[model samples]
Target: MPDLEPHRRELHVHCYRMLASYEEAEDAVQETFLKAWRGWDKFDGDNLFRAWLYRIATNVCLDMIRRTSRQVVTMNSFAEVPWLQPFPDRMLPSDEEPDAVVVNRETIELAFIATMQLLPARQRAAFIARDVLDWSAKETASLLDISVAAANSALQRARATMQEKLPERRSEWTSAELSDEERDLLARFIDAHERCDAAAAIAAAAQDIRVTMPPAPMCFNGLDQLAPLLERAFGPDRDGDWKLVPTVANRMPCSASYLRRPGDTVFRVFKMDVLRVADGKIAEITTFGPSATLKAFDLPQTL
Candidate 1:
């Protein structure tokens, strides 16, 4: 039982990959632990505890996917999966995780997770086992209860899907934890939003920046398209005073934004804006509502 404690974070991450929703993944991990405890007598101790626990976690996620619609997989963009959530870097498995379960940066990146959500469940499982976890074909097959050939076939299909869905800048992906340049840009972005300064906001962004808010079909792809949107957000016609607190999500620099209406005394959380900086400019922004996991961040309810 004590041995299982060390592997909890890794198991949670594996389940997270299987289920795109962060909260759902947590639920699945809890269930996995429960199942493991109830079936302890069935284990002969021949197989490693980590491997056994992962099998339980994977099956739990698979069952959940079987019950729910995989419609998010068929969607063209991540915004279509309104329930998609970020995993805080602080919650990830420690670097001390053994080589077999080491959680690599590229595999845990938000972009990587977003694209993984678009793959079929079995393919996603096969891909993670083979590529991300470095499991052998026989091991993956044994865990999935499939023939080795079938596991290889599924992995090949998953790889093709990944290449198609993932962005082209593989070289730049997860290049650093938080580079100095990105930090400067993030500071400017926070200042711009707090001041509601459209010019400053636009200045911090790339010429063709991309922005998307989940649960909304709104995706502004370029500066020309975003100009009016920025005006509406920051212009005098806006209804509130804004404040932003620096934060991090999905290993990217972000800000938790709050708004105070004309008569209100305290600032209330509005949303979280996660930024992607490239070459000294803001390349993309993904904004998420705070209602789902605001408490996870331990932020104050009022100013």
Candidate 2:
């Protein structure tokens, strides 16, 4: 179990990348542990425990994916189909005491995960394991039960695809340690949302802020566009009572928005929006995990 402790955080992250749902990631970790315990006798001391455990987790994720082809509701999906669920922050790990690993918003940002959804499953695993996690090609191959050459090829393909889709930096700019100003900005953002003040919310965002809603393709950019977006969100059509429940994903602070309904005793969990802030301005927004994942963060569906 001592060996397991070191890898638990990473296992959660890896599984989240594979399954793209925090609750599923937790379940995958538990499932991996059970499998590991049962197969402990067969374990070889020669292998790296982190890498070995990752293999089990990856396989578990793959099996789950095979069973359910998780769909991304994009702008396209929203236009063509019905109801696209927002990934809630309540489903992510708590932001207050995140894992020690470097916490960059992009690491678990819903936008990044949505981009990952575009790749083939094996390519997704290979890219995340080798490039994101810094595993070697040989190690990645061993984990995926593929040849080293195949892993290399998959990694290259994954890199190419990711580069095309996401041009953001590969390294993180922030860690568990956040700047005082950043923290203050997050507090203000939370306050603005709670107050349902569109002007205050817009003021907190950067001029070039961008928002993306996934399993749907609709993306809105710039303050000009975002102002109206917020206006509609907090405008006359609905009650303005909302709450922002703090959570974490990929090491950045996030909020699960809850809407109060008429005659309802508590605020009902609505959507999870993960933010990437740079220089006190919002850079990106990702809505990934469905409401079902909220339980992972100890968030109630209705609060």
Worst 10-residue lDDT window, candidate 2: 75-84
Per-candidate TM-score against the hidden true structure:
0.93, 0.75
lDDT string for model 1 (42-152, tens) is 986889777788888988988888888553646555577776777766677766666336555577766778888777788889999999888899999988999999999
> Please, what are the lDDT tens digits per residue for candidate 2 over residues 67-170?
87754433222222122233333333344443324435555655466567666788889998886777788888988999999999999998887787764664
Q: How many residue pairs clash in all the candidates, one count each?
A: 0, 12
For model 1, the stretches where C-alpha displacement exceeds 4 angstroms are: 71-75, 97-100
The candidate that wins on TM-score is: 1
Candidate number of the best lDDT: 1
Model 1 poorest ten-residue lDDT run = 69-78
lDDT of 2: 0.69
lDDT of each: 0.81, 0.69
